[model samples]
Target: MERARFDNLPLEWIRAFEAAARTGSFTAAAQETGVTQSAISQRIDKLEKQLGTHLFLRQARSIALTVEGETWLPHVQTAFESLRQSSEGLFGAARSRLTISASSSIIDLWILPRLARLTEDIGAQLSLRTMVLAAGAAQEDDTIRIRYGAGDWPVAYKVPLYNEMIAPVAAPELLASASDWKELPRIALSGPRPGWNEWSARHGTPTTPLPALRFDTFVSALAAARAGHGVLLASLPLCAGDLAGGKLLRVCEESLSCHQSYWLLASNEAVSRRQWNRLETILKDPVPREGA
Candidate 1:
């Protein structure tokens, strides 16, 4: 059997077929596509002829997909979805919704606090979406992406938000009269940052393992520390509020420069210059420092 050439199939016919399959009626498909019922029937017929297979089993009151049509439906639907997303990316969507995607930890610890100010500054409504950064995940081109890295995203307008500084922090109650803070249970972060081992080496703390509870994100570890569970190695920017309120205190004078920093990234067409500038300004404004 000869395979159909790509150019031989028209997009209009495919649209008609999809609408008919989805709506289950040629009349309804014609209404959706703004064509006559006969026109829709003709297009589906032409599509079936091009594919050398019958797609629909026509009935008195409705239509159902043939075995071949059922097999082909998902592929056709996926292709249409891809095309729609691509169109939205290129021309922008009709809605004024601005989406910002970032890691769950970043959103909770950093962005959420400043989100109201951001919306006020830009005078536009914004939506926040959390994304987990994993290898081989598709990058979202249609929304602003806040990522933690060395600030080298190709073909993107990039701005460094802030470099992270990490320090050992604990609830004030946890540190009460505790002479050897190192011996206390440590809440450890298991993610990308330099964690307990590096902090210990920097602060000259003993390398011996202590009672430890591990969390996949710094946010969770910080929460555990805030609840007086254990000492946490936490980022200063994210926990600045807790430190200032005396909810958490630095265990030692030692701090480590996280080399990795959070960066704001967007395609050139993703956001207007004015919108991007306002968002950057809002994010970069300094928060009240600990004890100040």
Candidate 2:
């Protein structure tokens, strides 16, 4: 029997395989491809037969990609992206309108500062949609979304916003007034970033002071900290530009390297392979803060 040529693998079969591998479920792949689960499974089976290797480890409730599947996934995604780039180059327009759904704090702190550069670099009309739910933008169906996590968003291209580095921050006046930065009134945030208790535990400080003020939103807490209300356990990456410009002062030398981070869930349509390199630079690399 002759080995099957790579190009002979049907695009639909490849799509089924890619979707199943990425989502880690035949049902999800079916939903994404607008087909039934049986069809997804059948296509994958055909592809596996063609390749003479199993792509997924079948389990009771979940599926794990075989090493071959894991290795081939990126290549498939890249090929699709290349095809998109060529099509876009020949037939697509000069600029596009893209809406980003995320929490208001991320819009205000991280993405907004680079708005001008981001739009210009990517050639898109950028629109910001502030997510109202406590879940943030994770549940949104917008063209782009940002989520906070350990960055395992396999279904979409994960554009890393930042690794969370948190430290206590305060306005200069508050720091000057208080002799011990640790004893200053603590401002608390309600979400994922670690608060005073975690900070204290990590630093081995026995007494964890109660927060003088608490807010459900990071932006509000940050505003309070900036207004000299209290010292905030700040996400350093989110406010790196501000720290660089002396708008906020890091109270201590120590910072906790929380394993989680904010990720921009980008698809090829959200940011094309052609534009992604430059777009990533605009997002990940530091830019000049506007309206300083």
Candidate 3:
């Protein structure tokens, strides 16, 4: 038996056939794909004629895939699904010039202040978007995503950005007046990272609830700490400015080494773009030695 050439098969016809096969009814497939049942039937008919094999057997109100169609259904379904995902993803990326998705805290405390230097030095147009950590999230269209995680990204090449450190911090006045560590107010910030609990555990101090003020991002938590509300569990580099300016003070002599590091993850297709390259440079820059 002669086999039909794969290139000769119209994509539309294959899609219609797959839909009809999956749904077991042309009317249902038409409803799913938003095309007339007649159009669906016509395409399948054309495909059958092209392949010189009957793809479906008609019944009273529904149809069943012939042996040939049954054998072809899985491959066609997989191909169409891959095509759909690629088209949607690439098209979305092409619409945006440059978008960077990062943790809200990093954007607020670290990246936002340093944005001007990058813009001036790199001399490129760019935009930043922020998001909280959630599993399997698309940060933005064709955007470079700076993620804080252990260095294993299932997709995309992961570049090590930097390791993070956390310590208990508060306003200078609050620390100066504070007599006992137990009496001090502890501010919980952002997600459950290396915070007061970790600090308490390390020093074998009893975990006491200190009139907690909770925040979803480090920026707000740092602001609250600066306002003299309470001591905050802050990322050292992120809170470096406030710490230097005397807006925030380190309450704990000990710090936690967060094994989780920051990473730069970009879509495979978007890696060669100029905007992505500039962002990569800033991410990989050497850490400055305490106000150097």
Candidate 4:
């Protein structure tokens, strides 16, 4: 009955193994770690050798955890999460910074504009981190996350930022063309959320296929629309500034409510009343009028 030695375990090897297990792919784990796939495989191999167990059942197209790996995964994840929380508590207090995670489009279009007001009100420096929703990024407990989806995330307090509404928008110049605007090339966003098909259904527009220009993010799609490349289906709150500034023009009066909405999600540890109040005030404030 010899006691197990903890000193021999390498943190990096465990990290590599955990990432690979969580993502179910060595390639994905490598991408997350900013390492080569071969390096990830090597690290996992080393970890398995050290532990004397086969952690993964490798297949041609996928990888599955062996029973040992499945049991080990939670412990590894919990360890990492604890480390993150401890580091944030130690370092974040010194900097007096609050970190927030949101999609690039949301940050660029909505949050960035109002950030100064938030900082001014909260008396703390704010750090913005882009959470690429398209990439399946996990939310960290150390930060507040502005995520778009149905409000059902467990272990986090969810606050409705806004009810999602989408409408067609284009540069004013697009209206000059003799062609019907509906027939104009449409910009499409490809992601978890619905796009033109859903918009059409909601607005009673015919579902006939139109010439499309696809972009992976709403930011890019909106940029293309502003450049007069095509009409874009834009989230109302995200585009409020553009519309107000006349950078973009609503193509029609019709707006469609989406099943999904932007939510402010914070883990229990992160959701202090003061911090919540700061965010609530920032979002609840009415957009300033022109020249006001």
What order do candidates take by TM-score, descending? 2, 1, 4, 3
Tens-digit per-residue lDDT, 242-275, candidate 3: 8788888787687888888678888755443344
> lDDT order of candidates, best first?
1, 2, 4, 3
* Cα TM-score per model: 0.64, 0.69, 0.60, 0.62
Question: By how many angstroms RMSD does model 1 differ from the true structure?
Answer: 11.5
Q: What TM-score does candidate 4 reach? A: 0.62
Off by over 4 Å in 3: 1-96, 132-136, 139-141, 273-277, 286-292
Kindly report the root-mean-square deviation of model 2 from the true structure over all alpha carbons: 6.2
Candidate 2: give the clashing pairs.
Answer: none
Number of the predicted model whose TM-score against the real structure is largest: 2
Badly placed stretches (over 4 Å) of model 1 are 1-95, 288-292
Model 2 misses residue 284 by how many Å? Answer: 1.0
Give residue 102's lDDT in candidate 1 (0 to 100). 82
> Which pairs of residues clash in candidate 1, taking residues 3 or more apart in a chain or in different chains?
none
Reference-based TM-score, model 3 = 0.60
Q: Could you give candidate 1's per-residue lDDT for residues 1-292 as a string of tens digits?
A: 3654446588999999999999889999999999999999999998888788999999898799999999999999999988865665566433356789987887887787787677666656688887875789887777888888888788446887787898889999999957888877888787778877787677778755664688887778888999999988888888987898999999888889977888889875667655666677777665722211
Give the best candidate by lDDT: 1
**Which window of 10 residues has the lowest lDDT sum in candidate 1?**
283-292
* Better candidate number, 3 or 4, judged by lDDT: 4
Error of 3 at 62 (Å): 37
